[model samples]
Target: MTLFTGLAAVAHAQGMSVSSSAFADNALLPAIHAGAGDCGGTNTSPPLEWKNLPQATRSVVIKMTDPDGAKGGGVVHWIAYNIPASVLSLPAGAGDKSGDQITVGKNVSGAAAYRGACPPVGDTPHHYVITVTATDLDPGRLPPGLDAAGLAVALAGHTLNGSTIVARYGR
Candidate 1:
């Protein structure tokens, strides 16, 4: 089975769901969520909330990725983990370099903060999947500064449930 299929199954069984107040699933993201440099917009992370997490969850991890980026290999826009399970939501701009109850991870650019979508100019809109994972690990179980691959390896079989919301963005 595919990785996404597995995550969907877990989400379904656990009744977990994630949503964004800034944009609905499969909707276009606002310009404020775009990258600041060439993308020409404020780099702000959207507000996100999760509900019905599994009982085994001790912490939550959030990741945002653009599957069509980097010539189709994918790009990691944000990776923040070590969020206490008691925390159910992240306010807008929470993925910034510093935040409460969250430990930022390295994105594609090696920055330990959110790097908003910046798809190539003139390309079709890219689909950005933002996933929230409920895990059995403690809030401080993993060290900070982990990249996407490192975070995945650490999460491994510890993920109890997960949910995703997709947003579209273009240059």
Candidate 2:
């Protein structure tokens, strides 16, 4: 086999898997997880689960973004990092910023809490991409007030392998 193919196999074996019991990948999000911009849905974060991480992973980062927002630059829905490797899942509304196990970085709204999906009224369904990265960094490596871009830099070269789940929503 080609070296690239072998590497892909090994990486897949070591990669973590991310999923949500709330909705399937590419599925529409339920109202409880949606924004309340006349959409009338609660602004709660969705539940997420992960598994199959490499043993060397020290922490995990969960970032959710809307590429369809921010006039093409992409809007950050959430930027939670420093999640202990022992944590395999986050319950709904965990992003409400009530725990110390993980650090919630600043999102587009300039708040550390999760900003649920709220596409412009009558706009096409926007895709929310939730990514979970297994990394070798310590729990407090990321400083406060760091947005998703800065968070990406902090996670650079430290991420082992990760997974993503994409869900669609629009008003």
The sequence of per-residue lDDT tens digits that candidate 2 reaches over residues 1-171 is 699998987776676689999999999988788775676577788999998888788888898999989777799988888888888999998875636888888879898888888888888999999999989987777777678779877877999888999999977
lDDT per residue as tens, model 1, 1-171:
699998987766679999999999999998899899889668899899999998788999999999999999999999999999999998899877656689999999999988998999999999999999999999988898999999999999999889999999998
TM-score of 2: 0.88
| C-alpha lDDT values of all predictions | 0.92, 0.85
| Worst 10-residue lDDT window, candidate 1 | 92-101
lDDT of 2 at 29: 87
Evaluate model 1: give its lDDT. 0.92
